[model samples]
Target chain A: MPTAPAGTLYRGREGMWSWVAHRVTGVSIFFFLLVHVLDTSLVRVSPEAYNAVIGTYQTPIMGLGEAGLVAAIVFHAFNGLRIALVDFWSEGARYQRVMLWVVLGLLVVTMAGFLPRHLMNVFGAE
Target chain B: MTAVLENSTDTSGSESQAGAVSSFQVTLKIRRYNPEVASEPYWEEHTVTAHGTDRVLDALHKIKWELDGSLTFRRSCAHGVCGSDAMRINGRNRLACKTLLKDINPDKPITVEAIKGLPVLKDLVVDMEPFFASYREIMPFLITSGNEPSRENIQSQADRDRFDDTTKCILCAACTSSCPVFWTDGQYFGPAAIVNAHRFIFDSRDQGGTQRLEVLNDKEGVWRCRTTFNCTEACPRGIEVTKAIQEVKRAMITRAF
Candidate 1:
């Protein structure tokens, strides 16, 4: 494809899009943190109640949900670092797109390592 | 050899202008739309005979006068000072009269469109009310509680030169519209606003640096800038927009410290 002249087309800035995605993920992780805090704070209520909350994770459906939560947290943290780099550093723009790919790679590797063990624990095979 | 070189206008050099026709041809692909007429905008092309020194404004005038009567645009100064001629030419924001035929390749067609992120009024004119509103929101002036100077207030040469580049802003809004953050969020103070704020912030003559910084410290102020540098790349006056934005950010942070 031929390159359009500078003002001809709106390329939809990568930096802006990346920052927006970071904000969204940060909000999501924040909500999950809130829920996790509530769930863990049940330990003060009763040991049995805490055990019941932990037992809910032994189901296959809940295990999948846990896997997704972990993925979201990991991706959000890695991409959050990328956003901070862009905000504070001079050379951050140079590696912005490369760091986005790195975030994706981390997301994939983390999901692969986490999902299987979570499923085994749910099914009682491990 | 000297005789051949002198007589040969072919691929060599010609003192007298050769093939430089008394009239040159230019094609202008202008984006057109009428809210009542069509659902979407379309391009209309006009071929005009232009002189070698003719600017894009001359070509637009030729089309408006000789070809199409409905073509609309804004131009106060035929020279580049008024800053009303800013528009997308061949894909970048530029003043129409400042762009000459010799500067751009005449063989390729020139595309003229309204400035980005603003409502298009007609052929090449854009509504500038929103741009000016943002400019005014920044309060582009000095404010101080101290009494007016009875005599000339003294300042060092370095202090006076601090905001020199920012003072050159013509309120053109070219830098603001070019910013990606400004395009996405209307609340953003934008580059031109920050540049104007810098004009007041660094002025030794003005005693409103803290007040201006407080205005810029709003949620939609300097924090909204993502440092894309598109504003710097797009400024016609060669102002270091991103550098000034960074300076403001540093000042804000240092003040907090």
Candidate 2:
């Protein structure tokens, strides 16, 4: 048997790309949740300690990071719904491409609406 | 190689040239590999003249018989029943015998390669041992309890219809190889294995549904499927592969509850 390489280079379409995105977002969200829980648990220690930890999230860098997290959540939610529909509905599989585009449209619209408001809250005069 | 018309005239014994056979040269860009000669697979081109209705299998036969003797592939019951000629055609897994040259863009060279995710034993033939091993692990056959009835096991039409689509699977491995998860992680049972499991699991006569579900409940089971739909698209038998996998997942969930 002749072996060119261990793994062949495969080009994936929208479905495959969506699955990759879903997994990536899932793992990112899991880690984000872990950090969120740890930071939230600081309130039990003391207000000063919680505030000190929360102060780091008030930075411009953290604001941009929050935006990326919001985008990941939006994509994961929309794509997760699409996967659910595909699993339950008989006709959902046929319109998967349409559903993906719809999810993308919704994601963009959501980010457009959310980013400005979120950034203003993060960088607003206090 | 350039396209050459081998037999431009109608050879079907039609005296009237009204529907004369039009022969055009087709270039097959086949991936060739010989362990004795080459360490890696390389592209080999062969130009064979074929009619509009000729399939990729016919072109391969023409190349093997006339152009190159060392060219190797598998084909049995060339009309697509035997499922021996499943390979990647133009980046999509398809049956070579079922794929018509005219259906694909004949002006361009048709690319033929072995199915992905499986080790190729020769030119287009892959080692199906791993694929069948997974299939066997799922226990594709019926496992009924109690004494065997003297008469045939009666099954309602609807009960039979529950698994009708999965019965179309010919163990071609097209759906399995097309799966990205299976390609990335070989431990995953793949779509074909799950589809086979669905067949027996849903069978009314089968008493092994619980055991089969337990087998698939492993870390590398149906949970690994991301519903990419590549298996559904790549299935040459038109089986609802993703749907079957989903049904199995639903069964697992139902059992859990």
Candidate 3:
């Protein structure tokens, strides 16, 4: 085998960066889904047990973590839609850079709307 | 004719611009590597006077012929048909013979390097054995059953047009090397190999579609493609490479159903 340099850092454009972000967000969502499923399944045991477990999620740290999860979900969903459009639409490849900016813009707008309300719930005294 | 030439030259003596082509200095920052001499690759810059219409290959040729005798690169047709001069120009994969000096911002220093994800053999030459190996694995040729046709294999215009775009491929590694998946993972079949598979898979006369689909069903085969559009952007032949790969994936899914 001819030995050559390995792991040369490739500088890719918006499409490549979108691919990397998609994969990263996908893996994070998968792990988060696993824990979510396990926690949601606890409702089968008793109502109080499920309520107690759900109450723990109201903490400020969990609020911030949930915000991160929401960001991941938003990015994954929007980017996945962009990938699908690029795959199916004939002219999608030509307008991909434009689509990436649109996805980013939508993500920022949606996160801005959700974060403040979610944080208020976490830090507010009830 | 001599009198006519003298008259024309005298008539336009101050403003004659018939065959006068302007040339400007352009710097080519080429990546150089020699395993026998140095363990690592290094940058070498050469400034050459070239016309605006000159291709990047012409600049390299000028540098080799005038400045340095040892500056090496590969070329055959000096046109884009041979697919021998595919390299990274200004951080993008393009054919040196097709990319003109002025098209890629010649005002700044132009960067010339070998295609990514391939082992560099020398300056601007990469080992193509691995790339060809993947091409061969996809069974690129037409595989028909039964006896050979007596005269010619007849097909309708629509049938021939089905796989026409992929036939334009010159086996250039530009699309494959530009793929981020192929850069990170060497085992992936890459877009070019899958595009070749798509050519035969969608062929109306080919009977090897099932076998090719089975070959690409592996983990490192067509499934590894992330549809990043890099391959489509890098293809010198302008083939819709990502769409062809997607067609193969769709074919596989249809087969499963």
Candidate 4:
């Protein structure tokens, strides 16, 4: 192993950055899904255990965490589709940077539609 | 920042023609390392006057010839054909011979360092064995299994055009070293290998598609490409590297069930 990375940092283009985001979001979503499955499975033990776990997830802080998780999932999903296009579509390679922009556009639209309503449901409700 | 070291030449009294440009001081910060001299690499700075038409390679030549006796870098053709002088210039993989000093903004000190994802032997030179090993793994030469041709190998221009883009590879290791995947784990087959494989695999005159595809279908093969375009962007020869890797992946899928 080389001790020093004396070279300057590589400035990768949008493709590299998007892949990085996709990997990070994917891992985050995986861990969140693991917790979700475990907490939801508490229902098998007892309704009280299930309610106790679910109640902690209803607070304001948990609401914000949920929002971030949603954002991650949305980005991962849309970026995965873009990756699929880069794989299967004939012109995908030539237009990959453009497709990344398209994925970001779709994410903004989807998030705009979902965030406001979901936030109201979390904060506006009693 | 270091003080001005030396200037190339005084041009104040020279003849001035139409649209003539003047020389300006360009500072270069190069990463220097030698295993025998020091255990750690250090940034050595030098400033030299250069015209807008000069290249980064020309500045380096000035430094090596006049300033330092030990400044080391590899080059042969110096005209971008030999592909020996690829380095990280201002955080980008580029050929020093091809990058003009003026285009990269000489106001700020331009940094030159060895390309990443390979073992640096000394200043601006890395051991290219690992790079060529992966190239050799794919069996880059044409493989024809049938009897020897009585006449010259027959091929149409259209057949030649199919793999013409990859033939421009000078095996510079620029694309392979720019790869983020190759940086993390050196086992990945990398874009260069796949691009070379795409060359012979798609050639109508070659009969090595199956063998090359099998070599690239390993766990660390073409499947590991995450579609990052670093290789394509880093190619000095303008090869569509990511597209070549994608084509190889598609071919692999078409091969298997």
Give the top-scoring candidate (TM-score): 4
lDDT by residue for model 1 over B1-257, one digit each (tens)?
Answer: 01112222344545444644344679999887665687567889999878766899889989989999998888898787788888777766777878897688878898888777777766677678778877787678767676767887788989989888888877667778777677667668888889988888888877778878888998899988876656766677778777788778778888777
Candidate 2: tens digits of C-alpha lDDT, residues B1-257: 12434444546655554455577889999998777897788888999888877899989999999889899898889887888899888888889999999999989998888888888877887888888999999988889888877898889999999999999999889899888888768889999999999999999988999999999999999999888888988888999888898888888887787
**Residue-wise C-alpha lDDT for candidate 4, range B208-249, written one tens digit per residue:** 899999999999999999988999998999999999898989
B10-54, model 3: which lDDT tens digit per residue? 445655646544567799998888888998888899998777678
Off by over 4 Å in 1: A1-8, A11-126, B1-23
Please give each candidate's TM-score. Answer: 0.66, 0.81, 0.83, 0.93
| Order of models, best lDDT first | 4, 2, 3, 1
**In what order do the candidates fall by TM-score, top score first?**
4, 3, 2, 1
Model 1 C-alpha RMSD to native: 8.3
DockQ of every candidate structure: 0.10, 0.32, 0.32, 0.68
Global Cα RMSD, each model:
8.3, 4.7, 5.4, 3.4
Ten contiguous residues minimizing lDDT sum, candidate 3 chain A: A1-10
Off by over 4 Å in 2: A1-8, A24-70, A87-95, A112-126, B1-17
Worst 10 residues of 2 chain B by lDDT: B1-10
Residue B218 lDDT, candidate 2, scale 0-100: 90
- How close is candidate 4 at the interface, in terms of C-alpha RMSD after superposing the true interface residues? 1.6
Error of 1 at A69 (Å): 18
Off by over 4 Å in 3: A3-11, A27-68, A84-102, A119-126, B1-14
Cα lDDT of model 2 by residue, A1-126, tens digit: 333244335556788889989999999999999999999999999999999999988888989899999999999999999998987776777788899999999999999999889989889887
